[model samples]
Target chain A: MKTTTVFTIGRQFGSGGRSVGRRLAEKLEIPFYDRELIALAAKESGLSETLFENADEKATSSLFYSMVMGTYPLGGGAIAGRSEMPLNDQLFLIQSKTIHALAEKGSCVIVGRCADYVLRDLPNVLNIFIHARMPERIKRAIENYGEDEKKAESVCIKKDKQRANFYNYYSDRKWDQSETYDLTLDSGVLGLEGSVDLIIAYDEMFRKTEGKKRMVST
Target chain B: MKTTTVFTIGRQFGSGGRSVGRRLAEKLEIPFYDRELIALAAKESGLSETLFENADEKATSSLFYSMVMGTYPLGGGAIAGRSEMPLNDQLFLIQSKTIHALAEKGSCVIVGRCADYVLRDLPNVLNIFIHARMPERIKRAIENYGEDEKKAESVCIKKDKQRANFYNYYSDRKWDQSETYDLTLDSGVLGLEGSVDLIIAYDEMFRKTEGKKRMVST
Candidate 1:
């Protein structure tokens, strides 16, 4: 069987990044996992959805992550209760496992959750980042949430910052830095459909390039 | 007679900012000046156009600007052969005079060269900064110049840096900072016509708000 390809999308909030990803997945006949990942991870871990949802796309908590990493058992032997494991760590473990499971299952488009880092070593993976200008983001936020202009603008900045911090903490990369991704699209310029088209076109090119490499290697 | 409102645009090169401004001016039945600002400034100063053009939108080299006001002179005496003024100083003077002249003359859209800072104190002036995401800017540069993709990408970064430096050196605010303008829109998101529509809407709001203020005062 041909190896399935997974696409991970990192995006600025309100940039229609999710919409683009959804359309791309539909057009390419791949599964699209977004908030659904949290549910699946929760089910897999037998944990409440909120625990996974709260820690979704976020790195291990800074207050305790360093402490745990420093003192926790490098091998097995857990000391005690669930609280000792740290909420973020449990969430991360479940999410990491779920990502591997999903990739093993089939090709999919994963939005956020630092999936790019979780599956970085995978051969048939493509990572993409999406961003738009402040005005464009604000406009989209207003349209999406019926927010007042000022509130919409604030939400746009806050969401992007959260996403950036999440990506940066988990990955060996500066989120939105543009260098690490297989492709980065400004959804503001292309809009949702256009962005989807661009990604599809890029995927075709990438596959062709990979095929050429395989032929050379063999 | 009513004072004419001029829309001054500051832009990164290869962003199609100039095209947006020119098209906007045409739609509004107003003059749009980019390169023409240099010629006009040169005509006004009786100096060679190259002097003004070379110094365009760069930091002012004069000691006064470097040490103090952080702006070029609007209307002033140029001491001939004064050890050759610094590049920044020449740029400052040219930008200042060019901005003031355009404002004093009538309604016009002056593209780039710090027209925003030069006419900040003036009434009925609209200043806009145009920007796009790295990918979009790179695409535009590649399409417009028929250059290699990598080369176009580098040019986009270089031009944005130049504009950012130029704007920062002269203005207290960041170049693309939304607070500096009455309205900020991403031309790439709104597209050319949408951008023009946004500006017109803002202009209408400005007049209505000003009218209300006048009524309240009386």
Candidate 2:
């Protein structure tokens, strides 16, 4: 039987990471999850999709409170004291649970929602971080997202900070920290297509090593 | 005329980054500078080579003082107040100058000595950071470097921290920070050969983009 490999991507805003992940999933013939994750989490947790969307990759004021009380959730489960958790924390737990379920179901590509941290224990998972230089990112924002040329730089910076805050608050690891990921690619240098190709190459090499390790263990 | 593209590698101890740089230089038919950079710097600055060897990638006590005074060097030249600088700072300036001179000469693979930071202004430079899992690094330290099994982990950690301190002190950027680099690869995942391949691939794509920009500008 063939083993499955799940890919989790954390990306900077306007870095083309989402496009890369989506294209990679298509190339690999796997399911891709991004904003689709919010709907899944909502359905699984019996929560409103809008709630997840609103709080998506945005840290809440109760972050400090949750951190102080150590109320973050890990793994898929119904927590004993989950009722007292903030809505943001509750949503995060639900999303994490959804990510866990998705990974268990089959090979897939998951973007953001701290999927890398969620699937940290799985040996079959590869975590990637995608970033680009500020100028290129700003240009991408302006071109792809139709962001205003004058405000695009600040918009990109703000979105990255929001993602970082959300990831840092929810996970034990910091966002965009190189050590936390198996590979970090500069989309500005590689371009979206090149990034996808490199990722596929890396994944192929990665699976071969994993196969050897599994054979040795078994 | 063909353009020169310098590659600067920053690495954790036991990551086989030195070997990777040397091998990459050989594959590309270019000069590889590691400890040889020390000799070049010594000759250029008329400083003792031992002084550079002693201060190599080891932050000095005056790091904070130099930071506060804004005495760090960036380009290839003698500073106005160079004589008054600490020995470590003087060595760093000399080394930075040597790096600048080497890069100016032709394409080369330079390992450590803050080559990435020194050559930051150059459009033809690719900055890479290589790291590996601690266990793998520890194992490599023991098997390859003849480090004692028990002390390998701490030795790796110490060397990495020393390099980080030196990089952080001399450059505007923090060591191992993902955004500071064009690419960061996990040797634990890709291994040395895979890393070298990925870098060459990225470099080819990067140069194509650079070539386009140059054509547009000219």
lDDT of 1 at A47: 70
Residue-level lDDT of model 2, residues A69-106, one tens digit each, is 47444233344566566667878887898899999998
The prediction achieving the highest lDDT against the true structure is: 2
Relative to the real complex, the DockQ score for model 1 comes to 0.04
lDDT digits (tens) for residues B1-218 of candidate 1: 23467787766666567888888888889888888878877887676777776666666545644543433443353545532455456556755876786688888888877787777666566666665545666777888878788698778777777777878887766775443443344444345565565565545444433311111110
Candidate 1 residue A102 Cα shift, in angstroms, is 1.8
Question: Which lDDT tens digits does candidate 1 get at residues A27-124?
Answer: 98989999998899888766778766767767676676776656644234332355466657767767888989998787899998888778876766
Index of the highest-TM-score prediction = 2
> Candidate 1 regions off by >4 Å?
A1-3, A60-85, A146-149, A211-218, B1-86, B89-218
Chain B alone, TM-score of each model?
Answer: 0.80, 0.86
* Cα misplacement distance, residue A131 of candidate 2 (Å): 1.0
lDDT, residue A165, model 2 = 94
Residue pairs clashing, model 1: B9-B112, B59-B88, B60-B88, B60-B89, B61-B88, B61-B89, B62-B89
Per-prediction TM-score? 0.52, 0.84
